[model samples]
Structures are given as structure tokens and as C-alpha cells.
Target: MTELLKLSGVHTHIGRYHILQGIDLVVPQGQTTMLLGRNGAGKTTTLRTIMGLWQASKGEISLAGMRIESRATPDIARLGVGYVPESMAVFSDLTVKENLVLAARDGPLDDAQLDWIFGFFPALRRFWLSRAGSLSGGQKQMLSIARAIIEPRKLLLIDEPTKGLAPAIVMALIECLKEIKRKGATILLVEQNFFAARELGDNVLVMDNGTIVHRGEMAALAADVPLQERLLGLSLEAHQ
Candidate 1:
């Protein structure tokens, strides 16, 4: 598979605390690479580091073979790297339409694009005129993802896209992600939801205590219940 992003010996420091110790990984083009680990294992930090939201204190990060660790956040974004933060990061005061309008960079919102997004997330269309703050958690998550894909993107760094949503919403997200994947978008996802990961990920990278502890095909990890317990202390059956 072709590589879209790579991190070599990447390290990050948050104040006095050392985070993301020596992260080395490759995100393949047109596939989803799931980043999974227990809480506080530096999953979020890794995404932040890749986005240039937090500069790597050491090592190199490249997107499509060009160095980008020192690039500004917006610069990295404009280079086709879209980020859907765990926090969702929607403008609470803005209407759904307004939020999407801001995410489109080149010109007026394309009707076809809006129709495509609405197909993936009909709630976004229903709440088009509503303030984002008034939407439910699931709706807001949908909106966050829709904003990231408002324009064409090459690589997407998504953090916990299924967090705190109902089973129905999770299923919808799963379908939406599958559609995104079918369109050949490269995705680096951080998810605790193993069920979702198993369905969407082609490759998997497992982290522990600020370092990658495992790397393999998602099917290999998902099928090995013993390995899941050892790596994540999680029961694959429970997640199912």
C-alpha cells in the first residue's frame, strides 16, 4: 500500500510531562488505520502532534514525503489533512449552515456537496438553521465529522468518532465511515470502540504509555481475543 503519512521516532512534551515517546508508524493511502489503546495512553496526544497542534519535541513527521512537523496548523490542514478532534470543536453559537459555510475554503458552498453530506447525515440537513449548541451529542458529532469533510481531504485524523453516542448513532457513524472509506480517503482513527474499529480499520496500531506496542492488520488483532485482553485489557465479546 502507498503511504500517505509517516512518523519516525516522534516525541512530544506537554509542559514537564513527556508524552508520545518514539512513535513510528505509517498510514496507508485510501485506507483506515485505527490507533487504539486504553485511556491516557497518549492516543489524543499523537493526533495533536500529527496535526501540528503540538509540535514534536523530537523526530520527524511527513505527509506525502514532505516534512510538516513545523508547519502551522492551518497550513497542515490546507495540505489535505482534516482533523475531527475528540471535543467535536463546533462553534456553539453558529447555526449548522454557518459552520459548514466556514469550513468550505475556495468558494460558495456547493449544492452537490451539501447534498452529499446530507445523504451521510440527514440530521445535519434537518438542523441546518439551528444553533449547533442546541443539538444533541450524537447530532453534534455528526456535524463535527461533516465539517471536516466539507471539502475534499486526503488524510483525516479522527479521535474517538463514536464516543458517547447511542447504538443507532454508532451504526450510522459506521455506515458513514464506510462510505468515506469507499471513496478512498486515508484515515487515522483513535477509537476505544473496538466494534467500530473492527468494521472500519484496514490496519491497526496499538499504543501504551506514550509508545506504540503493537502493529498489525486489524483482522488479526480483532480475531485474537487473547491478544486483545493482553494489549487492551478488554474483552472482545463485551465490545461486541
Candidate 2:
């Protein structure tokens, strides 16, 4: 597989804290790669750094073989990168329709694409005119993800998408992501839900104390309970 996104010796600093320390990873083209770890493991920081939300203190970040470590956030987004932040940063004052419209950076929302999005997240359709702040937490999460896929992107950086969602909605999100993967969208997902990770991830990277501790095939980690416990502190079976 071709490498869509690559990071070599990447490091990030927020004030006096050194968050990411000599990180190295690769996200292959047309595959879902899961970043899993305990809280404060620098998973979110990795996603943010890739999107240029936080500038890398050292090393390099390349997208589609182009150097992008020094690019601005908007420039990175314009380079076919879509980011779904863990905070569910929707336009609180705007209606659902307005939020989606803003997310369609290229131009007006495509009716066909909107229909497809609605199929996965029916709540967005129901509250098309409702204020984003008025929606529930899970609904906001759905909207956040929907905004990222509102238009086709080369790579998607999603952070803990199923954190506050219901089981049924979680399954729906899994299927939605599966369809995206089928359409050849490369995804770098940070998820705590091991079941969703096992279902959607082709490869997995485990982080610890701001560094990658393990990297391998998701199936291999899932089948090995001891390895899962050692790296993630819990087995996939136990988490599920």
C-alpha cells in the first residue's frame, strides 16, 4: 500500500510540556489505522499535529509525499485533509444546515452527498434547522463526523468519535466508516472503544507517555489477549 501520510521523529510542545517525543508512524493509503491508548497518551495531540492545530516542535510531516509540517491549518485542510476534533467543535450559534454548509469548503453542499450523510445520521436531517448547541452530545458528535465527510477528503483525522454515542449509533458509525473505507478514504482514528477499533481498524498503533509503544496488525493484537493487556491494559474481549 502507498503511504498517504507519514511522520518522522515528530515532536510537539504545549508551553513547558513536551507531549509528543520522537514519534514515527505511517498511515497507508485506503486503510483505517487506529491509534489506541490510555488518557493523556498523546493520541489527540498526534491528530492535532497532523492537522496543524499544534505546530510540530521537531521532525517532519508529509501528506501524499508533499512536505506539510510548516503549512497553516487551512492550507492543510485545503490539501484534502479533514479533521473531526474530539471536542465536537460545531458552530454553536448556527443551525445544523448552516454548520454543514460551512464545512463544505469547496462550494455548496451536494444534494446527493447530503442524502448519503443523512442515511447514516438521521438526527442531522431531523434537526436541520435546530441550533447546534441545542442538540444532545451524541447528536453533536454525529454532526462533527458528518461535517468531515460532507465533502470527499484524501485523509481524515477523527478523535474518539464514539465516546458519548449509544450502542446502536456506535454500530451505525462503524458501518458508516466501513463504507468510507470501501470508497478508498484513508482514516487515522483515535478511539477508546476496542470493539469499534477491532471492527474498523486494519492497523493499530499504541501510544504511551507521549510515544508509540507498539505497532502491528489489529487482528494480531486482538487475538493475543496478553499482548493486548500489556499494551492497552485490557483485552479486546474484556473491553467489548
Could you say which candidate leads in lDDT? 2
Tens digit of lDDT per residue, candidate 2, span 1-240?
899999999999999999999999999999999998888999999999999999999999999999999999999999999999999989999999999999998899999999998999999999999999999999999999999999999999999999878999999999999999898899999988878999999999999999999999988887898998898777766655
| Candidate 1, superposed: residue stretches over 4 Å from native | none
Q: What is the lDDT of residue 237 in candidate 1?
A: 56
Give the Cα RMSD of candidate 2.
0.9
| Model 2: number of backbone collisions | 0
For model 2, what is the alpha-carbon lDDT of residue 115?
A: 93
Where does candidate 2 have its weakest 10-residue lDDT segment? 231-240
RMSD versus native structure for model 1 = 1.0
- TM-score of candidate 2 versus the correct structure, residues matched by position: 0.98
Residue pairs in steric clash, candidate 2?
A: none
How far is 207's C-alpha from truth in model 2 (Å)?
A: 0.8
